[model samples]
Target: MKLTIQRHQKGKSYEETFDVASLKVTTLLAALYEIKAKMDESLTFDAGCRSGVCGACALRVNGRETLACSYTPHDGDRIEPLNYHPVQRDLKVDKEKPQETLKRVLPTTIQNPKSKIQNPPLSSEDEAKFRVQTDCILCDSCYSACPVLAVNPDFLGPFALTRAWRYHTDPRYIEEVPNDSIQHLTSKIQNPVLLDTVQQNGIWDCTLCGECTAVCPQQIDPKSDIMQLRGESLKAGYSDPTLSTPSFGTPDFGGGFGFDPNAGF
Candidate 1:
């Protein structure tokens, strides 16, 4: 099959079409591998956990970021590297910094004071609720789907923020520990929007566009999580700089984003 890859090298961006299906399974990475092994030995890309567990293989498929190893090849799919990260070669980009940003944001779990479930027990219902979030393999599809990270470098990507929410939302993490070091850290340093910090570095910036939700193979809805995060922020008295009248349905944090409380979707 014929493949067109968006290539970047030496500060230039261009596309290179190659005939690789003369060889492999047409898996996106396999096709690229064929081209690299048979045609251009110098071609470069990064991949690991070919099953999609590792986000290392992330790339842009027709202008959207997706993990190359996990993406099945389509006849005319245009393959490019991920945006918002430095391209290291033909289909590889550096994702560490963004992932690190999430770490800086205190991405972890915290138990709610009212949670009935205990950490060790891990009730079936609560487990089901968080199962999808736990399935995230760091494929970075959510990061690719995030609109805020597209324009605002300061806006931490979904994986990081979502992880933080997982910790805070997990009844286990928050149990009996009214607050801990992480809470303090989320309150002070990393201070992500979803991590219950006072500043605007977290959820307030999320557009909740559902792109992250759509691209997630594991079915985690970072968009919904982000919206829930907004509610958490509001209850915490986090003010929306963009909101004026403070009225209901006012979209107080209208940084170009969504939903009245009852309309949570």
Candidate 2:
């Protein structure tokens, strides 16, 4: 199989072709590894926990974001580094930028409101809350696929927003008083982390393009999560900037709109 690799370093980019017909590897990472080991030792790329759990091998195949370790390459496939990231070297992009956005969201549980739970076992319904978000392996496929990042570099991309949603909905962050108050009325002041995502470049920026969900290897839908986050943000008294626009409510034009009957045409 023939492979075209787009490589770059120090602001210079180039493509190199390789023939891997002899090795017969099923996955792209395997082919690259074979080439590195046998053909070219200088070839640069990133791979960790080859089972796709680590998410270090995320790259573009045929212009789509995917995990190289899990993707099976086709003949004449074009492999490139992820988009919206600074290429550190061939097929290796800087992860620090994306990492920083995630850091800003505060992934850890911040100030659990309840010291001890009266009920020991969590209900299945409660467990379902955070179950999907936990599947995210931080592959950054969603980040690369995000069209918002293409135009707005400062946009806090999908994964971060999804993570913020995960933490916001966490039962640990809630003070469960059983029948004391409606679930919606629970005070948010106990955990400040939930409110952190209400600022600029938060959930409102998302265009709901669904590209993030399309590229997510783990099947985690950051787009859907962000929508849910928007709802939560609204319930917390934080309104979307777009929602604040004053509606004129259909311009009232008396008697045939622009022309008056008394005025001669």
Candidate 2 clashing pairs? none
lDDT, candidate 2, 107-194, per-residue tens: 4443453546554465798779879998898888899989888778989999988888777666665433333333345354433445
Give, for candidate 2, the lowest lDDT window spanning 10 residues: 175-184
For model 1, how does the per-residue alpha-carbon lDDT over 87-176 read when each residue is reduced to its tens digit?
787777777877776566453455444556555677798677667777778767677667887678877778877776675566565322
Q: What lDDT would candidate 2 get against the real structure?
A: 0.79
The clash numbers for all candidates, in the given order, read 11, 0
What would you estimate as the lDDT of candidate 1? 0.68
Instruction: Quote each prediction's TM-score.
Output: 0.76, 0.82
Q: Where does candidate 2 stray beyond 4 Å?
A: 107-121, 174-193, 245-265
Which predicted model would earn the best lDDT? Answer: 2
Q: Could you give me the TM-score of model 2 versus the true structure?
A: 0.82
